[model samples]
Target chain A: MKKTLFEKIWERHIVDTLPDGTTQLYIDRLYCHEVTSPQAFAGLRERGLKPFRPGRITCVPDHNVPTLNQDKPIEDPVSRKQVDTLEKNATDFGLAYYGLQHPRNGIVHVVGPENGLTLPGMTIVCGDSHTSTHGALGAIAFGIGTSEVEMTLATQCIMQRKPRTMRITLDGQLRAGVTAKDIALYIIARMTTGGATGYFVEYAGEAIRQATMEERLTICNLSIEMGARGGMIAPDAVTFEYLKGRAFAPRGAEWEKARVAWQNLYSDEGAVFDKEVHFCAEDIDPMVTYGTNPGMGIGIREAIPSLDSIDEAGRISFLKALDYMGFRPGEPMLGKPVDYVFLGSCTNGRIEDFRAFASIVKGRRKASGLTAWLVPGSRQVEQQIRAEGIDAILTEAGFALRQPGCSACLAMNDDKVPAGRYAVSTSNRNFEGRQGPGARTILAGPLVAAAAAVTGKITDPRTL
Target chain B: MRNTFTILTSTCVPLPLENVDTDQIIPARFLKATTREGFGDNLFRDWRYDESGHPRPGFVLNQPTYKGDILVAGKNFGSGSSREHAAWAITGYGFRAVVSSFFADIFKNNSMNNGLLPVVVSPEFLSELFASIEADAGTQLTIDLPAQTLTNQATGRSEHFDINAYKKDCLVNGLDDIDYLLANKEKIERYESLVTSYKLQVTSK
Candidate 1:
């Protein structure tokens, strides 16, 4: 049968097809973090069984680990125990670990790319939802649960049901002032979060063709928000170029062979998809989220929409969103007060993101009433920002450059918006209280984050 | 305890929204501890409990009439950060399964591997389940794993569901990947030795 690249990889990984039409899939890699692994390891211990493919499983401590402290034991007892447990589990289980102060230690997603562990035509699973961040390298990556973490650790393969496929092709040059982050927000806004349900989406377009790897990751990283099981882009020169000199990439003559193999990872012409959506990049602007969901967003210039225009069935949804967000109908999101501004996460926290923010905030100070925290996604990102003078620029502008972690994005650590405070963030989700209880988050790009810091309002970066 | 797989059809509580995230399932505040117990009570903690930790009257789970082991949710259930506590809370709270038109990749995998079934039904079937659950909170459903069908005994209608064969095998036989590998340790040892020898050959070459 004719197949897409997705089909070929999936077919190669299929262990069996069940009586009920679900295929038993095999996992290639299992990535886990400190927070979710302890219970899973205990589950394994209770069963008196050891990991089957320890070499294929890797562990990292990110979520609960404070970004700043490296030399000392974790201050919080609970967090200390979580990190300690991961180190012990990884050690006892024979899995590779990037413990704190390990040169490679960083956010799991960032480490995956930097290590060349996320390769073309691979299946990657992590006990972290943003595992889709690995898909930027043309791998099929999805987040798994702690039990599935144990499953992969024990067997190196996870039982699975394949999702249907969706292809979202955006084919035009983007307008100025719009970055890949805007493109992703635009796609989610159009797709309504559930649009890609039960599907793995492949993003292909002229705009994507021009996007740097960081941008591809930014798009794929948010696939979960659009209701995709995950998202991927086929490997091309850009993929090979990014991997050529990486630490884990194939070397010498082997590199040539790997490139040849990767070239075959693209979707074939006339491939049939379960669903397809298209967008013209020209239509997208510097998009920012309005209500509590990633899907509830608009171009920066647009006003917050009134609920009346939607279908009657959607009125409750619109009203619920407004109630949760304390939003008024037909009000422009511009000049909306913000208590905080966050500039980090798996989304938009790379070196490019920092450069964008530093450029905007270099000469200007953060808004007097607002607290701006700029966190790098990885130590590498933080190092680059510091080396490139981005951190200095931020510091001079009254923005504190936080150490790297998934800080304030989900409030997994100390950085979180307090109850009833409004924040402008560059993270993926803006769900009600995603930053903290009753913490209303408006998702925007880094440029907009800087703008929110400077103006203390959810203003358009383009207008800045 | 002998590992047991009891096929249970959950009584549905209607949660009507797409993309219900992990934070909504079990908030971060409830996940602070390394231990997994006590979280079941705090499942959907902020939403389920009022500011003083009193039960919120408007919350769906608190509505006295809708009681059951299964939760039928709208599309994109369990979306957001990979918080396994969401699954733990659901399972700890005694939910045997979750029926949804779609489950986020991470949450579904977590649910299935942890012995909590994530039953994916067609949207049409999901709507029917929601309608039945809403119209009659006393609705009792049967999830037959061997049959791969979710049947509403009251309505006498069954929706076909799918589970991966390996998961089905393990679930029925109560064999996790570790248990299965242990049962075939000889083959694994041989494969490991083979990999070791292969590396030696490559290095020598």
Candidate 2:
């Protein structure tokens, strides 16, 4: 039988079928972080059990660590405790840990791929929704709850009912100014936040094939936003080239052998998906979200949809979202004053993302009243920013690069937008108060965020 | 872990707003806690409270007219982030079940594993639930887990839902993922050995 790319990787990871009809899936790699893993580690201690394969696990403290002043101890007692617990747990379990100030420390999703821990035809598990970010390398990765985290730690496996498969194909060439983030936002708008529930999605077609690995990572990072179990792309030459010299990647003869195996990781030509959708890359715009949910998005030049255009069942929530955003029906989102602009997160905190942001902000002065944060996804990305002179351009434009952490993408850190402020963010989510109490997040791509940073409001990059 | 989840019949608190994501359920700032306890206090903390930290009179849970063990929320409940704190909050707040027209996949799984029943009903039925509860503060719904049915006692309406057969068994037995896997340890070890030998053979080739 012809197999889809998801199926090919999934079947390889199956250990056995449980009597209850769930598959016992073997996990190749497990990534842990400060926020979610403490409880799982506690669970392990309570049971008097140790990790089945300690070397297969890697721990990092990202969610609770401060983006600034990493040399000092965390001042927030609660955040301090979480980070301390992870450090102790990692040491106790004999797992590799990259805590704050470690040379390789970064967001779990970013560091995994940067260090070449993520690989093709592997099954990765992390206690994070953005673990799908690793699927860019053709790995079958997804988030797990604390209990499932404990399951993976104890047995190196998880019990899961296989999900149906869906394929989203993006064909044709992207227009200038459009980005992987824009394509992702466009798809989420068309699919709604719950569109692809109960399935694993495989991204294919010309545009995806053409996307850089970082771009592919951005696309896969948002898979959970649309309610998919996960998303993946087949490994190709681009993938191999990216992984070739990474710290943890295979070398020499092992690399050659791995390449041979990864070359066969694509879906067979005749394989059929349970559901399939196609979009022209030209149809996507430099996208932005206007409402509370990521799904409520439109092109930069477009107006928010009128309430009359929405169904009765959805109209009430639609109105509520607009009320929360302080946006009127049928109003153009362009030129709306933005108080803050954020450029970091697993979604768009990569080196390419920084380059894109720097490209737009090159010679322009930042808007007088705007506060923009430029955070890198990893230390490697931060180093690249400095090495490539993007940091100088940013500093010249009045935006300083903050330390690497999941800052402003979430409110766990000190870098939070104040109440009732509108922030143009490149983060994946724009949910109510996700950045802070009463802060309204407007989700956009790197270019759009850069435009907002310099213009002090939502502006069409095309107009800029 | 608490076991044996057979049936639950209780009143419900309704949150009519749609897309009530996990972040809203429990804000990211509150996620700094290492343990799962005390999250119930912050369940819907921002929505339930004003900036000054006083309970908002307008929020559903704050209203004295409604009180219940079940939380009937709007569609796509528990979307965003796999914090598991959302499930922790619902269960921590003593909600035996959460009913919605749809649930984000990870949230649903987390709820099921954490001793909280996630009941998925038809959109029309979900609407009926909101209306029925609103009309009468005394509204009670019964969720029969083994039977896979959710019934509205006020309206005498009932709907059958689907659950994985294995999950159904676990729920009834009060078994979590860890419990089940531990019970089947030998099976796991055997499978691991098989996988090890298989990998070795492939690498040798």
Candidate 3:
């Protein structure tokens, strides 16, 4: 049978079919971070079970680690306890652990692909929604609950029913200054948050094929926001080029063989998906969210939708979201004042993201009223910033680089936007209080965030 | 870890807001704890309490007049993070089931795995549920897993819901992923050997 990329990888990992009609899927790699793994480890301990294959698992501490002062102990007792517990659990299980301050330590999703731990045709599981980020490498990856995390740890497998497949095809070229982040936001806004529920999406067409691996990762990282089980891009020459010299990637002869296999990873010509949607890439703009949900976004130059534009069932929540965001219908979002600008997350915290931010703020100074947190996705990315002189440009422009961690994205650590303040963030979700208690977050790309940092308010990057 | 759910009938607490994300269900600050047991105290912590830890008077969970084991929330409940802690918080706060017009895929899966039912209904039926509960605080509903049906005892209204047959079976038997996988150990071993042979053939060539 002709199959899509998702089905190809998924079928290769099936261990057995249970009487209950769910597939027992074998997991090739399992990534764990401090915030979600402690309970899974505790469950394992309660059952007196050790990891089925310790070598298959990798652990890190990111969400709860402070982005500043890595040398000192975490001052927040709760954060300190979570970090300490992950280290202890890793030690007890005899698994590879990249604890805070360790060179390998970084955001779990970033660490996976950069280290070549994420390979094509593999089944990856993590207790993080951003696990879909690894799908850029042509893997079947998705998030699991803590119980599934424990199940993967004890058996190196998970039970899953097959998800229907959807193909999202983007054609045409994206205009200059528009980015992968904008593409994601634009798609989510049109599709709404629950549009892709119960489906695994395979992103295709010319625009997706032309995107850089980093850009593809940014796109796939937001799959969960649209309620897709996961999203994948087939491995092609670009995918092989990105993996060629990485640490955990196959060696010379093995690489040649693996490349040959990966070449066959695309969807068959006659393959049929359960559903299909197509969009012209030209329609996407520098997007930003005006309301609490990520789906409540509009083009940077467009006005917020009027109440009459929304359906009766949605009018109430639409108004409520506007109230929380301090926005009004028919008002342009371009000149709204911003108190903070956050330019990091699994979605856009990569080196490419920093370069984009630096390009915009090279000679301009950061606005005095604005406070910006520029964090790298990994220590490797931080080092690259210095090597490439992006660090100096940012510092001269009145911004400092923070250590690599999941900072301010969800306010798990000390980096939090004050309540009632407006922050133009490059993170994925802009749900209510996602940054901090009562903190208002406006989701945008790095270009928009950089523009906000320089102007101290929401301003179209094209205008700047 | 809790009771095996076959049929559950209870009054409900209503949160009429749409897109109640995981962060709002249980904020990220509360996620740092090593144990899952205490999350119940902080469930809806920001909305439930002020900065000084005082209960906010306007919150539904805070109102003494409303109490139940089921939470009838607005559309798209649990739409943000993949934190299973959200499910822990809901279950810990004594909710056996959450009824919504829709649920974020991961949250629904997480709820089921943790012995919490995520009962999805039609949007119109969901609104009727909200209206019924608002009219009388004592409105009761019964969820029958075996029959895959939900009935409003107050208004004599009923709705059919869909759940994965595998999940329903697991929930009714109280069998987790580990338990079921362990039961199929021999089949899994056979499959592993087949995969190993296939790999050996490719590498040898």
lDDT of 2 by residue, A187-251 (tens): 99999998988889999999999999999999999998898889999999999999998878877
> What TM-score does the first chain of candidate 2 have?
0.99
Model 3 over residues A1-464: C-alpha lDDT tens digits? 89888888888888887676689999888999998999999999998889877887888899988999998999998889989998899888788888777777789899889878888888899999989999989999999989899999988888898999999999999999999999999988988988887899889988999999999999999988888889999999889999989867887888888888889999999999999999999988899999988898899999999999998888888998899888899999888999999998899999999999999999999999789999999988888999999999999999999999999999888898998999999999888888988899999999999999999988888887
Clashing pairs in 2: B3-B174, B4-B174
Model 1, B1-205: lDDT tens digits are 2255657755667787766888888987567666667768877777798767789999888998887888878777887777889988898887878888888767876776667788898888887877887788888889988778889876899988877667777666766655654455464445444431101000000
Encode model 3's per-residue lDDT on B43-77: one tens digit a residue. Answer: 99988999889999999999987898999998889
Docking class of 1: acceptable
> TM-score of model 2 relative to the true fold?
0.98
Docking quality class, candidate 2: acceptable
Chain B, per-candidate TM-score: 0.86, 0.92, 0.92
Cα error of candidate 2 at position A125, Å: 1.3
Worst 10 residues of 3 chain B by lDDT: B196-205
Candidate 3 global TM-score: 0.97
Give the DockQ of candidate 2.
0.48
Give TM per candidate.
Answer: 0.91, 0.98, 0.97
